[model samples]
Target: MENSIYQVYEDEIQSLEEEIKMLAEKYEDSQQESTFFSDEEILMSMKSFQTEFQGELKGQESPSDLKAQLESLEADLSFLMKFTGIWFTSHSKKTVEKTGSRTIQKHRLSGNCHSLPFQLEFQLLEIKSKESVSAVITDLNVIMESGEYSGVSKFVSSTEEHGNLLPFFKSLSSYAEWYEHRRCTFLHFKTRYPDIVKLPEGLLGDYIVLRNPEPSGFELMIVWKIHVDEDGRTTPVLDLLTKVPEQVLEQNITTIENAPTCFRSMLLLFGIETAIENLIKVVGLKK
Candidate 1:
């Protein structure tokens, strides 16, 4: 039949999309697994910094020469991303040196946390004495897409309080990882069951509705959310919601009412993907 042939093409296209998505996810995971720069690039940048610092210590160059060297060093450092899943592509800095061998610098850093982009603006005041160097960060600010960072206001507040960006980057990376997983999961199901799965908010949504292929079955919804705590811990939360007609509920009140609870139990027994697959099967769908 013409309908059957069309479905065959659709299924093939879905298969190709899944393959591409798999390759993309692998690339992203590799990026998270390794630093942006190779070992050689990092070593070169570090050695360059050493050379610049040594030149500064020589005390033989003019102030202009020192400034030029420092500027060069900063530029080099800006390109080298040494942290895993965290890298600054560009930055701006203003440095002030005091008579007591102390220096104060203000830095504005623009970077990405894995695939999630963020811009960090902060002032770093570094004080150098004969024996030691001390640093303080102030006027901390973060700019990110408001939608991407909806639930993590407390994380920002805590990061500002502690003047630490490491925790924030780590949390952001983990959160983004979970976020991608949810997105891809929804996409996979929506594509696989195009007639049965409906997304109210497109692919970026937090939930998917699974309708029965036949008219006799009730509708099931899966809600997936990624949670980030103040301590930089990330968790994925999933729940099931259902809507059944009055006739169906009257015929099977216990099953209709207990679907959510049963789903939670299934989630505990089996993982999320498996639980979702089982739930779909239970909805009287062929797949």
Candidate 2:
């Protein structure tokens, strides 16, 4: 009876082990199905990511094309600028030309003649030269008949008797230095500027140089005057004088009331201000 009980108990224990193995296999299979679905979701996410990436790439392509076009246009503009010598505007060019022409006319009409009508102080009008230096000299002549000598003078043509006297006047070339440095030429100023003299006919000052004093130059004093008729036609007269007043040297005055703006600008640019300041200090302190 005890041996039969042991056999029945062993069979019951073996059956229970088999049932536990079956339950474990079913749980593992269910876990595997859930894992497969999770993998599928991850794959879908990867596809959506790739689609978004492709859209962004397509959008960037259009902007890249636009950027390339802009670059090409800028290059063309640069090339065109180089090809054309004109970098400024047409309006600017016109304005500059007009201003330049007006300045030239102004200077031509009221330019400085070699001689000042009055005396200048502390400044020398003497010209230093080696050759038969024909000095472009100016002298003050009074405005009156040939016999009467008083008042300012005006422009007058050279007469046959006074032919030899014309040579004494310095060549325009010497005075040309003054004009060349300023980029200007002498315009028979008598015709343009009437205020230089006060006369109706014939010039008052003798624009002549002395020839007898060979190789040396002399300064002639002259006064300026103007003469006008009933009509607008004007005549400039100059009177050649023998001597200028000693007191004239005490004060120097310029007939050209103003300086050119271009010259003024250049002076400012070329450190003239500093030089002037230094000069003032030296002169003021030295005394």
Best by TM-score: 1
User: How high is each candidate's TM-score?
Assistant: 0.66, 0.14
Deviation of model 2 at 58, angstroms: 2.7
Q: Local distance difference test, per candidate?
A: 0.76, 0.32
Model 1 is weakest, by summed lDDT over 10 consecutive residues, at 94-103
RMSD of each: 25.2, 40.0
Off by over 4 Å in 2: 1-61, 88-287
lDDT of 1 by residue, 92-182 (tens): 6655333334445567788776667888888777777788888877778877785656767777778878877777777888987777788
Q: With candidate 1 superimposed using the best TM-score fit, by how many Å does residue 155's alpha carbon deviate from the native?
A: 1.8
Tell me the tens digit of each residue's lDDT in model 2 across 1-87.
Answer: 998899899988888777666556446544643343455785675457555555466535554455468669869866764453212
Error of 1 at 140 (Å): 1.4
